[model samples]
Target: MAVHKLLDDLYEHSYSLIAIHSPLKDYRLAYFLNHQLSLKLKRTKDDFSYIENTSFSTFHYNDDTTDTAWHLITNISKNVVNETRDTDLFGIKSTTVLHYLVPEYKKVDYFLKIDNGDFFYQLNAVLKIINEMTHVVTAYTVDPNQLKSKNNLIFLSNA
Candidate 1:
């Protein structure tokens, strides 16, 4: 599957997932961190330990508990960019969720928006990255009804 090449092209370098919780929960950040790390690093559950294996740190929105917190995943802490949005979903917040394709990942023609953002912005982000890919492809899991194939964004049913 494409995930194999997506993983193979990125086999050597690191990758990160920026997962934001929809319902808003205390553990969403932590849970996604665990899942992303384990999946990206190919680490087994027994080996998942941020303190022991990685320098990546977790940050949460301050004083704005209502604004959903995003999981900023990246091989390099520098790849994660924070911004403020005036959008409907989370506005006037201190932190925003987005990632840049580091040099290592640019060659791979794909992007992923596993579970993130309001429909408009997330798809926009997906397109921005998708346009950068040559033969590579993008895939993400979301409710089928919410997917819009403007440029063929790969859809994954939650099952």
Candidate 2:
């Protein structure tokens, strides 16, 4: 009898995730990143929606010079729900629910994903420039492999 083993490394993650903490809105942060990193990131036509009624704003930029793709995605999505009950004076209650792309890092405002195998060497410099932005509270790298929702980062098809 011959034995065969399955290969688990078929889908290798060749990307780097950088968690950004900032108060700036998605577009504003993209603007700051564009100015600081010399990247021309623009909003995509369709927002990334992994679940019903929840969508995350996404910005994309492809650096032809370096043959790399960059994506700036909001980590949080807010949805409002209206509920009616006789106990309330107005009989209506409004609630806001939050959704996360990577639920493990709920406090992270945004994620910067770089799709290039060789970009890790320059990751530190990129983080430094992002951190220096006045509007950005702080920016640091996050290992995608360690994320429980790592598969959510696969947005190339939607992009």
Candidate 3:
């Protein structure tokens, strides 16, 4: 009799991550990307929600020609809560709490994820165009394997 073994590669990463720092809003950034990259990215019906009362805005575009999926998601999520406080003016106060999708790169405004991108994909060209945008401060490639919260990026299925 021969022993049989099974291998599970479900968690293997086959996508590219790009960190973008920009002052533009999510829609504005999507518009700029659409114009620059010739992609028609649109906001999906549902935002990417991981935890309670926290959700990140997401824009998606699928290129049927290349069979690649692009997702642009915000790194930060803001939630406002009302609480009772003993401070001078008012007993009740509202506070804003911030949540990060990828805590390791908190400074990054957004993340551009390219899924099913093959060898022919021009990553450098995309980076160059993003970097040249007037509203974008910088854009650079990031290794998903190096991130601790890399699992959070598995929202591709939701799209």
Number of the top-ranking candidate, with TM-score as the measure: 2
Residue lDDT tens for model 2, 1-159: 999999755677689899999999999999999999999999999999999999999999999889889999999999999999999889999999999999999999999999998998999999999999999999999988888788899765225
- Lowest lDDT block of 10, candidate 2: 150-159
Evaluation by TM-score, superior candidate among 2 and 3 = 2
From the highest TM-score down, the ranking of the candidates is 2, 3, 1
Candidate 3, superposed: residue stretches over 4 Å from native: 1-9, 86-88, 119-121
Model 1 lDDT tens row, 6-109: 43222221122322223222234335433433322121223112332323232322113322222222222222344678775865455433332222342322
* Candidate 2 global CA lDDT score: 0.92
What's the TM-score of each model vs. the native?
0.21, 0.92, 0.90
Which 10-residue window in model 3 sums to the lowest lDDT? Answer: 5-14
Q: Best by lDDT, which number?
A: 2
Provide the overall lDDT of each model, using Cα atoms, as 2-decimal numbers.
0.30, 0.92, 0.91
User: Can you list the residue pairs that collide in candidate 3?
Assistant: none
Screening candidate 1 with a backbone cut-off below 3 angstroms (N, C-alpha, C), the clashing residue pairs are: 109-136
